[model samples]
Target: MAEVDTEINGYIVPKNSQIFVNKWTIGRDSNIWSNPDSFDPERFLKREIDIRGQGFDLIPSGSGKRMCPGFPLATRMVPLMVETMIHNFNWKPKKGMKPEEVDVSEKFGVALQKAVPLKAIPIKL
Candidate 1:
């Protein structure tokens, strides 16, 4: 909720109005991202960007006072979990499925998820 009436880009925003920031769209804006539609993790390799909300471009966990309290926990746990999974098992797509044939479409809801459930076989190492 807005604390006071404010004007954004010449438009008057009434006081106490709820404002929803579409972070997803912001992330995909071509002006803000290079090759926005493509999945490129390496883009950040040479850049210094903050994910804890300081960097306006990427705030997956959000930023500022309203940011997710679990950010710290997630930062540590998520990587550890991924490392453990990679170390313990060898993963492959379901038999007969080629890696390049996997569907990467997104299903938007409370959070964006794969449009089709990813089915893979994990063999214990």
Candidate 2:
């Protein structure tokens, strides 16, 4: 691994070097993902994988010992937020739409988000 790193040192770069990590490409690598462009959350459901950063295959927060300190917080916050939304209401498309038909285009910035805000109807449960 060290020799490989040294060999590619000029082509690729370390954190302090001129080169930088292209997180977007890494996240959407077709070689690692089944349908890299698709937003199939189900792909992760049955797997023992998680977004906890330890598993680079699906590290939403990041990986390694220097990973996000907010990982545990986000872990707690995300599911709670989803649960709250699910328990409080039912979400559906505007009309004549299905989950699979939902567009998943992303816009990049400090963080990525849907290019078009997901328009869904929320009915009080």
Candidate 3:
């Protein structure tokens, strides 16, 4: 909640009122990002921005009081789990699905997720 009546970016925010930021819009803002809508993972290599709340550009897990409690564990465990899976099985997309055909569309709801979840066939090695 806002502490006092404050004007931010020309918008007046009432005192004690809740404020929400649309993270999606921030990611797609052309002013802050070049070709924001395009898939360019290399952009990160061009600049140094912290994801752990220090920098506003990337805070998917949030920061401070709102930070995800499992962020530390998740960060460490996810890569190991993925590595285990890759080592144990040969993976492929669902039948008839090409590498580029997989849907990358987002479903905006209580939580963001893929509109069409990836269906993979894992053959135990």
lDDT of 1: 0.86
Off by over 4 Å in 3: 1-3, 38-46, 111-125
How many Å off is the CA of 81 in candidate 1? 0.8
Number of the predicted model whose lDDT against the real structure is largest:
1
**Per-residue lDDT for 53-110 in model 3, tens only?**
7788877777788788898898889989999999999988899998777777788776
Q: Which candidate do you rate higher for lDDT, 2 or 3?
A: 3
Give me the overall lDDT of model 3. 0.82
Give lDDT tens digits, candidate 2, residues 45-121: 76677677656666667677656898889889999999999999999987999977888787876745598998999
Position 39, candidate 1: lDDT: 75
- TM-score of model number 3: 0.70
Q: Where is model 1 poorest over a 10-residue stretch in terms of lDDT?
A: 104-113
Best by TM-score: 1
Candidate 3 or 1, higher TM-score: 1
lDDT head-to-head 1 vs 2, winner? 1
User: What TM-score does each of the candidates earn?
Assistant: 0.78, 0.64, 0.70
